[model samples]
Target chain A: MALTRDDVEKVSLLARLQLTDDELNSMTEHLSQIIQYVHQLDEINTDDVAPLAHTLDITNVLADDVVADCLSREAALQNAPQRDEECFRVPAVL
Target chain B: MSSPETQPMGGTPYAVVVGLEVHVQLKTNTKLFCRCPTTFGQPPNTQTCPVCLGLPGSLPVMNRHAFELSMKTALALNCTIPYFTKWDRKNYFYPDLPKGYQTSQFDLPMSEHGHLNIFSENDEFADKQIRILRAHLEEDAGKSMHDEAAGVADSRIDLNRTGTPLLEIVSEPDMRSAAEAKAYLQELRLILLYLGVSDCNMQEGSLRCDANVNLHIDTPAGTIATPIVEIKNMNSFRAVQRGIEFEVGRQYTLWQKDKQVLGDMPKQTRGWDEGAQVTRAQREKEESSDYRYFPCPDLVPVVVTDEEIQAMQQQIGTLPASLRKQLLDDHQLTAHTSAVIVNQGLGFADYFLALATAIDDSRLAGNWMQGEVLRILNEQEQTIQQFKLSAAELGELLKFIQSGDLDNSKAKDVFAVMIESGQSAADVMAELGIEKVDSSQLEELCQRLVDNNPKIVADVQSGNPKAVGALIGQARKENSNVDPGQVRQICLALIEKL
Candidate 1:
């Protein structure tokens, strides 16, 4: 299936991405090609095989509910682009 | 335009349809996927780590205890546990979410097809079974604090609550009114509390709810259904009822003007502005496809066994509904009295059981629990666990009344002193100068009253039984230790001999 300009635009909007007209056209072509390449798997016959959730042959990989060490407030906020004294600051959501 | 009628289409009847989605935080020590403590009211960012913060190289793992707690809750709610369950990544863009996607369950959930019965003894609402569609476990996002008072355009993010384990239970639209919705919430909260799975504290955000509401109007032009609106930000159960009521009215008014049907408009999202008591439209509801849910490859799927499910079922000891029934049947208590005890939570119910069993009189124990025990709990703002007098001790005090050593009023005086000094009932009675008059002494006193009040004795022999009231008052004035009831009985017997 070919991806249209509108599909690319909608995807970008959901991802909060901004694209110029030229970039949009290129992205539309690139995404369509990628979809076409992935669609080749539809040719395989796997009626008997069950769908795989994970590659590993394992299940129920869990940890006990125990508290360990946590990063200090200073260390946690060190990598924030903008921060107040104790919290990471972002643009107003509303 | 023609003037709209005061009522919708000349008083056409309508029924409100409501479905609720409740999120309860599991009482786990650590985060769902990490070792960070899930403590509330901590300093901002102090509990953050690479896993919860969604660092590039960090991998997520499930907490075994959290999963077990969720299963326990679902089982208590009568949900069926699926053998296989997998986690999915729900993609979204929000500042509060450190990860670009939230880890949730999509096609396969932990449990499904459960039902909870909501009823009130007073018949405030009809008894109905609220059907549960599904219950899934997910991670909670961080909190975003926007300071309007500071007049800042920036919002501060607190990651302390990030990655907390949350079990979201979705119910079908089975509620017909606001009162049923509130009852459903109360019953659900009570069950969660009984299972010890979640604190179910609304003030601390341990429990939160969102409601989807709409109306079905019966008009001359067939049934007109309104668009479903999802309401959020209801801090209390009362707010939930009021919000749904407001939404129903709002939808009816809008339908009167435009006659818009269900599919005429997309589903909307609204927030309950509690101060104004109005539901303000927040935004258009997002379609489920927009989230683009896909199975997460980072975590392996969980396969539960039959034995594990049975173990969880056993772990959930008597829930509130069954316990309420047990109290009514075993103790032969009135429906109102049984409901009062069970609704105080498991601790208070346990106290009542211990007291009733110790004294071997449920009626007496139930009365004391509903009257004195509950009154003390409310007056001092204390829980049953924090109560000064233990059930065993209270039972010992009530035994005095049972044995006719002390009357009800005198026993209350002893109970007061016992609570204050932590003394035994006998000790408190002695200290209060309330001596138990022996049967011989009581008989002698009655005989003297019988002889002195010959007129009263004649009146009683003539079938004027109430004439014994004055003699009993005289007996009490003579020996302050005598019980009024015992005095009356003895006086009647002595007068009968005449």
Candidate 2:
């Protein structure tokens, strides 16, 4: 299926991406090609096979519920774009 | 019952359909995928780690206890537990979401196809079944507190709540009215609390709910279905009921204006204007997102063996509903009284049970607990665990009342002193000089009072029965430990002879 301009625009908005009008047209064509190439597997359907969710065959990779040292308040806010003394600051959010 | 003018939709009588999504934070020691402490009201960002902060190359490892707790909840809810389950990433953009994606259980939830029995508190529906669509496990995002202190323009994010284990339970649209919805939420919270999996305190944000509501209007043409609107920002169960009630009426009125609003209208998202007491539209429902869900490369699917499931089932113990019924049937307590005892946390309920066992009078024990114990808890701001009086001591006090050694009013005074001094009933009674006067002593005291107060005796002789009240007060003052009713009887008998 060919990806339309509207489809690309909608996804871009969901991804919080800003694109110009010229970039929107080219991105739609490129995404359509990528999706088409991936959809080729649909042509050769092995009905007997099972769908794979993980590449590894292992399951239940778990850790015991134990606490260890964590990052301090200062270290956690070191790389924040904006921060107060003890919290990360950002534009007003609702 | 509503009057014709107060009826919904100008007396159109539309049917309301409601579904609920309840989010409860699991009471685990650490975060779901990290070692950060899941402590509430901590200093901001102090509980952060590389994995929870979504730093580069950080991997996630599932907390085994969180998964076990989730399985226990599923089993308690009568849900079908899947043998195999995996996590998926739900993508979204929010200031509080550091990873921009939440690790959640998608298509395959932890449990599904369950039903919660809601006994309407006062609604006409005797007992309703609210179907459960799914219950999934996820991690909570941090909170963004708007309008920082000192009139700061920016918002502040607290990461202490980030990465906490959360279980999202979704219910089918089986609720017909706001009362039924509130009952369903109350029952669900009670079950979770009894299971000891969550605190379920809405004020502290440990438990939250969002409701999806719509209306169905029956007309001459046909039945019209209104677009579903999801409501958020209800902080309490009462707010939830009121919010759904307001939304149901609002939708009916909106649909009456234009029939075209039903078809092809996108589902809307609204916020409960708590102060305004109305549901305000925030935005039109956007197209569903392509979350691009896939199993996390770092974590593997969870495989639960039958043995583990059986163990979890055993851990659930006796449910609160069964205990409430037992208290009603075996102990002959009222349903309302049983609920009050059961909702006082497990410790209080167990204490009452011990007292009931020690004394054969469960009703009286329950009354004392509900009246005196809870009053003290409220006044002193103490919990059942912090209550000083032991269950045995309380039982002994009740025995004193039963054997006519103490009256009900005197017992309350002793209870207060016992709680203050942490002393036994016998000790407090002795310290306060409280004891029952013998019948002979009471009779003698009444004879003395009647002989001394001739004016009151003449009034009593004239057959004014209430005139004897003063003689009873005089008897109490003379002994300070006489039952007033006994005093009245003895005083009237003495006056009859006079």
Best by TM-score: 1
What is candidate 2's lDDT per residue for B346-432, written digit by digit as tens?
788998899998888999999998999999899989998888888998998899999888989999999888878888888889988
How much is B181 displaced in model 2, in angstroms?
A: 1.9
User: Would you give the TM-score of chain B in model 2?
Assistant: 0.91
Model 1 ranges off by over 4 Å:
B1-9, B443-474, B488-498
Q: lDDT at A7 for candidate 2?
A: 93
Provide fnat values for all models in the order shown.
0.90, 0.93
Q: What is the lDDT of residue B193 in candidate 2?
A: 89
lDDT of 1 by residue, B1-498 (tens): 121122355567788889999999999999999989999998889998999998899999899999999999999889999999999999988888999899999999999999999996678766778999999999999999996756789988999999999999999998887888899999999999999999888878999999998888878778778899999999899999999989988988887788888988888999999999999999787688988999998999999999999988999997898888888888999998899998999999999999999999999999999988898889989999999988998999999999988899888888878877889998988888888899999899999999998888889898889989999899989988899988998889877776
Position B26, candidate 2: lDDT = 93
Which lDDT value does model 1 have at B464? 89
